[model samples]
Target chain A: MPAASAIKVMVVDDQTSMRAMIRRALQDLGFKDIRDKPGAVEALPAVKTDRVHLIISDYNMPDMDGLQFLEAVRADPVIGKTVFIMLTGSADREVVQKAAALGVNNYVVKPFAPAALKEKIERVFGELT
Target chain B: MMRRIPIVQGEHAVVAEPGVIISTLLGSCVAVCLQDPVARVGGMNHFLLGEPTEGLGDRVGQERYGVHAMELLINRMMQQGAARNRLRAHLYGGANIIAGLGAIGSSNAAFARRFMETEGIAVGRCELGGTKARKVEFMPYEGRVRSSVVADAPPPVLNIKPLTPPDDGDVELF
Candidate 1:
C-alpha cells in the first residue's frame, strides 16, 4: 500500500460542495495528489491517462451514474485494478450488493465525518500511515 | 392543527384536510405539487429523473422517474375526490448542483411544465433553477407553497423510510 502523501486519489460527484468536502478530508489525511471531477463522464478521460491510485465516487448522477462508471473503470485494461470507494446518501441494499460484486474496495455513507472517511480508507489501504 | 408530512425521493402523499404540510428536499431532482382548491385536496411527489428509458431495465425500482411519479400523484388526488380539471400545479426543485453537466434541473423543470400543459392543468408558480438545492413545503388544502434555497447540502437522510419487505416469498429490493 502507498503512503498517504504518495497516493494519487480522484474524487467524483455531481455536487461541487461534496467534491470540495471530500478533497478537504483527503488533504487533512495528508493526501497530496488529489483530483476532483464533477461526475463520472468528466473523470473517465483523465482516469485513463492519470495514474490514480484510488477513486471515491458518488452513486447518483446525471448521464453516467456511479455504478456504470465503476463498470467502465473495471473494463479498462489500464485502470481496472484501481481501488474504488462508493459514497452515497442512502444505504440502498441492492446498490450496495451490486457495488460489492463490481469489486468496490469500500463504501462510505454521506454526511460522514472526515475521521470516518479516513477509517474506511485505512481499511482498504491498511492504515493511512 | 398543522401537521407536517415529509415526501422523500420516489414517494408521494395526498392530503384532503387543512393544516397539513408536505415537504421535501431536492438536488438535481424535481418535486411537483398539485391541489384542487374547491375540493380542499392536494398531493406532492419527489422524483429523481425526468423519465424512464427502455434501456433502464424494469420500472419496479425506478419509481423516482418523473412520468410515473406525476401520474401517481394525479391519480391519488383524483381518488381522494379532487377533480382533474380544477387542479393547479406548483413546481419546485430541479437544481444543477454540478457545474459542467447538461442542465438536468432545467430539463426537469421543462418536463414538469410540459406535462402539466399537455394535461390542461394550470401552473400557478414555479421555483426552479440556480445552483443551490431547495427545501420545499406545500399545504395541499390551502394551495400554498414555500421554498427556500439551502446554503449547504443537508444530510442525506430520507424523512420516510422504505417499506419493510414481507417476511415470506421472493424478496424484492427497492
Candidate 2:
C-alpha cells in the first residue's frame, strides 16, 4: 500500500458541505495531502498542472459533469493514470457502465458512511495501516 | 403529532391531512411547496437542477429535474382536489455553498420563481441564496414552511422571520 501521507488526493464536489465531509473522512483515514475543488472545471486545471495521486469526484455538477471530466482525465497523457473514484446519489446502471468504461477505480453512492468511503479508497490503494 | 415524510432528491410528496409533514435537505438544490388554501391539500418537490435537458441520461432520470418535478408536484396536488387558482407557492434551499462553481442555486431559484409565475400561481415565501445548506420542514395541509440553516455541529438555527412577499415585477435574492 502506498503511504497515506504520500498519496496526494483531490476531492471535487459542487457542494461545500459534501467537500468538507469527504475531506473529514480522508483526514480520519490519516490522509495528509488532501486538496478540494468545487467542480470538475477547476479540478481539471489543477490535475493538469499539479501531481494528484487520487481523485474523488461527485457525478453531478454544473458546466462539466464527472463522466465528462473522467473522460478528459483519461484522454490526458500526464494525468490519465491517476486513480479516480466517482460519488453520486443515483445508482443508474448506464452511468456506472460509462464510468467503468472510462477506467474509474471505484464508485461510491451518496449518503454513504465514512467507513464505506474508506473501504472504496482502500480497495484502490490497499488496506491502510 | 405530524408524520414526517422525507423527500429525497428528485422526489415529490403530497399530503391532504393536517398532521403530515414533508421534509428535505438541500444544497444548491431547490424545493418547491405548493398548497391550495381552499382544499387544504399541498405537495412538495425536491429538484436537483432547473431543467430536464441538463441531465445526460434516459428520460426516466429526467424526472428529477425541476421542470418534471415541478409539474409532478402540481399535477399530484390537483389530483388531490387542489384548485390551481387557489394554489400558493413557497420556495426554499437555493444556496451557493461552494464558491467559484457556477451559481446553480441561483439558477434553480430563478427557474422555480419563473415557473410559478408562468403557471399563474402566487408565491407566498422565498428563502434562498446563502452559503449554508438548509433543512426544510413543510406542513403541506397547513401551508406552513419552516427552514433552518444546516450547521456542521449542534444547534441548528430556525429561520422564522416574517416573509416579505416578493413583487411579481422583480426577482429578489435572499
Candidate 3:
C-alpha cells in the first residue's frame, strides 16, 4: 500500500452533523486530505474531477442514493474501482443484502467508531496494493 | 412477564423495577433518555415531527412537535429532583422507516440535537437516525437502555380480514 499521506477520502451524507462526525473520525485517524458533502448528487461531479482514493457514503439520501453513486463511479473509467465503503444506520438483512450485491468495499452500520472505519480503509488500500 | 406499555409520540414515563419502556412503532420518530448519575433515575420519551404543534387532533390534543417531547422528558427529571447540571442523555430511533424522502429522520435528529443544546445537557451516547423500528427499555436504577431495533423491510403488513363480508351466500354448511 502507498503511504497513508497519499490517500484522499470523500465523506458523503445528507446530514451536516453526521458528515461532521465522520470527518472528525477521519481526522482522528490522521487522514489529512478529507472532503465531505451532503449527498451523492453533490459528490458525483467532484469524484469525476478530484484525486479521490476512498469514498465513504451514507446509503440513503434525498437527491441520489449511495448505491446509485457507486454505480456511477463504476461506470466512469476516471473513478472506477475507487475504494467505496457505505455507512447506514440500519443494517437490516435486506439492506445488507442489496449492498453486498452492489459490490461495496465495506458496509458499516451506524454508531460506529474510527477504528472500524480505519480498519476498513486500511483493508481496501491493502487489497489495491 | 413483561408488560407492554404503548408510548405515544411526545410522551415519557419512569418505570419501577421490572417495568420496561415500550413504544409501538417508530418511523421517522426518535426516543431519547436523560439519566442522572448520582440519582440513577432515568426518563425516556418518543418524539414525532420537528417542532411543537399549533394544531390539535380530536383526541390527542396538540404539540408543536419533538420539542414538546424533549421538554416533557426534562420536566420529569426535574420533578424527580435530578439536578439539571448533572444529567446526561442518550438518544435512539429516529428512522426514515417510511419510504421516499430521507428528510424526515434527518429533521427528527436535528431537532433532538438542537433541543439538547438549548437545555444545556450533555449527551453521553446515542443511537439515532436510521430506517428501522426500535423497541427500547430503560433500566432506571442503573441508567442502562437496551434496544431491540429492527431494520430492513418495513414492518410486516398484517393481513387484516374484513370484519363484515358483502353478502352471506348459501353454501353447504360443512
Candidate 4:
C-alpha cells in the first residue's frame, strides 16, 4: 500500500480537455498529487514505477481503448492489483459488463460529478483501511 | 410524458412524448435515428466502430454493428406503432474524434450514410465529419438531436499522442 502522504494517481483519456478538467476536479477535491494522460498508450510506463495508487481511465481510445488498457494492466502482475476506475460519456452495457469482468472498482459516466469520483476513491481506500 | 427507456449502446427506442427528444453522439462511433411521422414513433442508436466484434450479442447468428444498430432503431419504432414506410432518418457526429486514433470515425460515418441509403430511409438532417469533439442529445419523442461541442481537446501539435501500451514503454508518468 502507498503512504497517504504520497497518493499518486494516473488519469487516462483520449480527450485532452476532459482530462484537464478531471485533473482540476481532483485538485479541487483536495487530491494534491495527480497526473493526467491522453490515453492508455501514454499512461502505461508512467504507472510501472510502483508509486501509483490509482488509475482513472477512459474506455474508448485509439490504438487501444479502455478494455485493452485494463487487459494490459492485468497482464502485468506488478500493476495488476492497483485500484482501477473507468470514466466515459457512454453508458453502454458492454462498458459495464467489461468493467465488471475486469473487477474495476467503479464505472462513471461523462459529465460526472467530481464528488462521485472522489467518493468511489474514498470507498476503495476505506476498504483497504 | 417522457419515459426513461434505457437505449443501450446499439439499441434505440421510440417514445410518445412531444417534448422529449431522442439523441446520440459519436466521434469514431455513430448514432442513427429513424422516425415514422404518420405512426408518430421513432428510435435511435449509438454504435461504436464500423465492424462488429467477434460473436458480439448474437442470439443464433447475428453480427450487430453499424448496420445492426440502425436496424434496431427502426425496429423499436415499429414496435411503438410506427409504420415501416413512413420512417425518416437523421445522422449526427462521426468526427475525426481524435487524431492518430486511426480511421474509425471516418469509416463509421461512411457506413452510416450507406446503411440509410440502402434501407430506403429518407435521410433528412445530417451533421458529420470534422476535427472537433461533440456531444449528441437524442430525443425519441421529438425525433431529433442537438449536437454540441462540449469540450474541445485539440491534439497537442507537438508531442501530443501518448507513447505507451499499459505499464511499460516510456512516456514519463510523473
Candidate 5:
C-alpha cells in the first residue's frame, strides 16, 4: 500500500461544484498531491506532460468525454497502464462493462461520500496509508 | 385547445403540427426540444443520463442504459421531416435539487449542451443548473418553451457519518 500523500492524483470533471466536492473528499482521505481539470481537453495534456499516478474522471464532458480520454490514455505507450477510476451519474451495467473493457481500474457513481471515495481508491491501491 | 403530452425519463415525442404541447417534470434530468422551422417538425426528449460518443462500437448501447436519449430525439426529429442541419434546440432541467446526490444535474446539462455543440445544433434558449425542480412545456412547431419552477426549497443536507462500506450485497467492486 502506498502513502495517501505520496500518490499524485488527477481529478477531471466539467462541473466546478463536482470538482470541489471530490477535492474535499480527497483531502479528507489525506491525499495531498491532488490536481483537478475542468474536462478531458485540459486533463489529457496534463497527464501526458506530468506524472499522474491515478486519475479520477467524470464520464460525460465536452470536447472529449471520459471514455474517449481513457482510450487516448490507454493507447499511449507511456501512460497506458496508469490507474484510472471513472465517475458516472448512474450504475448502468453496460457502462460498467465498457469501462472495464477499456482497462479502467475502478468506478464510482455520483452522490458518493468521502468514505465511498476512499473505498474505491483502496480497491485500486490496496488500502492507502 | 392543444394536445398535451407529458413525458417522463427516457421518453421522447415527435410532432409536425401546431396543436400539440409536450411537457415534462425535471430534477437533474434534461429535456432537449429540437425543431426545424423550415420543415415545421420538432420533438423533445427527457433523458436521465449519458453523453454521446461517435464511432464507438455499439456506441448508443453503451451510453446510459443501452440508449442515448439525445440521439433518440434527434432521430425522431429527422424522421418527422426535420433536417439535421436546421435543428434548433431549447434545453431545460439539470437541477441539483438534492444536496447529497452530488452534481448529477450539472453532468446531465453539460452532456446535453456538448451533444448539441458537437452535432452542430444551435441552442436558442435554455434553463439549466439550479437547486429547484421545474415544469417545462414545449410547443414543438413554434419552438416555444414555457418553464416554471414547481419546487425550490433546498433539500435538507445529508448528515453523513463515516462508517464502514455497506455490505448489503448491493455493492459491486469493479
Candidate 6:
C-alpha cells in the first residue's frame, strides 16, 4: 500500500461546504494530493484524466448520486479498480447492500469526525502513518 | 404544569424528574426515546442517519448522526442514574412527506431500529415509515410518548395583527 502522501483522493459532493469539510479531514490525515468536484457529472471526467487513487462521493446529489457514480467508475476499464468510499447521510441496510453489490470499498456517514475517516481509510489500505 | 422543550434536528435532552416534555416535528427524520424505568431516568434524540463512524467528533457538528446521538443520550441517562441493561426505547418519525424523492424516511427508520438492536435495547411503540409528517411529544421521566400526523395539520396562528402601512416616501408594508 502507498503512503498517505502518495495517495491522490477525489471528493465529490454538490455542497461546497461538504466538499471543503471532507478535503480538510483528508488533509489532516496526511493526504496532500486531494481534488474535489461539485457533482458526479463533473467528477467523472476529472477522475478519468486525473487518475485519483481514491474516490469519496456523497450519496445524494442533483445529478448522478453516489451509487450511480460508483457504477460508472466500476464500468470504466481504466479506473475500475480504484478504491471507492461513499459518503452518505443515510446508512440504510438497502443502500449499504446495494453499494456492496456495486463493489464499493467502504462508506462513511455524514457528521463523521476526522478519526473516523482515518479508520475507514485504514480499513481499505491498512494502517496509515 | 409541564415545561416543553422543542428539539430540532441533531438535538437531545434527558430528564429524571417529571413535568418536562421534549417535543419535535419530523419529516424523514427519526427520534429515539430511551428510558430506564427502574432508575426513572430517560432522554430522547433526533437523528438523520445511523452509525457512520464508531465515535463522534468533539464538535457539536457531529450530533446529527444516530450513533453519536444514541451514545450521548445513553451516557446522559446513565449520569442521571439509569442503567444500560434496563433501557427501553420508543421510536417515532421517518415519514416520506414527498413522493419522487428517495425513501429517506424508510432509511432513517431502519437505521434507528438497527442501532437499538445492535445495542441490545428493547424497543416499544415504534411508529415509523409512512407518508405523513408527524409531531411527537415525549415525557422522558414518565416514559410516555404521544404522536400525531401533522402533514395536513394547520399552521399555528400568530397573535400579532397585520402591520399598517406608514405614509412614508420609500417605506412600504404588506
- Candidate 3 residue A87 C-alpha distance from true site, Å: 0.4
Give lDDT tens digits, candidate 2, residues B1-174.
669998777678999999999998887778898999889999888876633333234322222245545655765686788876788999987787767656877877777787777667899889977768888899988888999988633223233121111121121110
Best by DockQ: 5
DockQ winner, 4 or 5: 5
Candidate 2 interface RMSD after superposing interface residues? 18.7
Model 4 lDDT tens row, B29-52: 567767777766766776664333
Q: Is the docking of candidate 4 incorrect, acceptable, medium or high quality?
A: incorrect
| Complex DockQ, candidate 6 | 0.04
Error of 1 at A22 (Å): 0.6
Worst 10 residues of 2 chain A by lDDT: A88-97
In candidate 2 the C-alpha lDDT for residue A90 amounts to 36
Query: Where is model 2 more than 4 Å wrong at Cα?
Result: B1-174
Q: Can you tell me which runs of candidate 6 are displaced by over 4 Å?
A: A1-129, B50-64, B153-174
Give, for candidate 5 chain B, the lowest lDDT window spanning 10 residues.
B160-169
Q: Tens digits of per-residue lDDT for model 6 on B32-141?
A: 98999999898888776633343235332332355556756776687688877799999998777767657767887887887777667899999998888788899988
- Candidate 2, residue B66: lDDT: 58
Clashing pairs in 1: none
After superposition, the stretches of candidate 1 with alpha carbons farther than 4 Å from their true spots are: B1-174
Q: Ten-residue segment with the worst summed lDDT in candidate 5 chain A? A: A88-97
- TM-scores across all candidates? 0.50, 0.50, 0.46, 0.44, 0.52, 0.51
The digit string of per-residue lDDT tens for model 3 on B50-70 reads 432322231111122354345
| TM-score on 0 to 1 scale for chain A of candidate 1 | 0.95
Candidate 4 residues A1-129, lDDT tens each?
A: 334335778889754445665676676655667888776887887798644888999775656778888888877889888888876443345675777687777766543445556666776775211
iRMS of each prediction? 13.3, 18.7, 19.5, 16.4, 11.0, 20.8
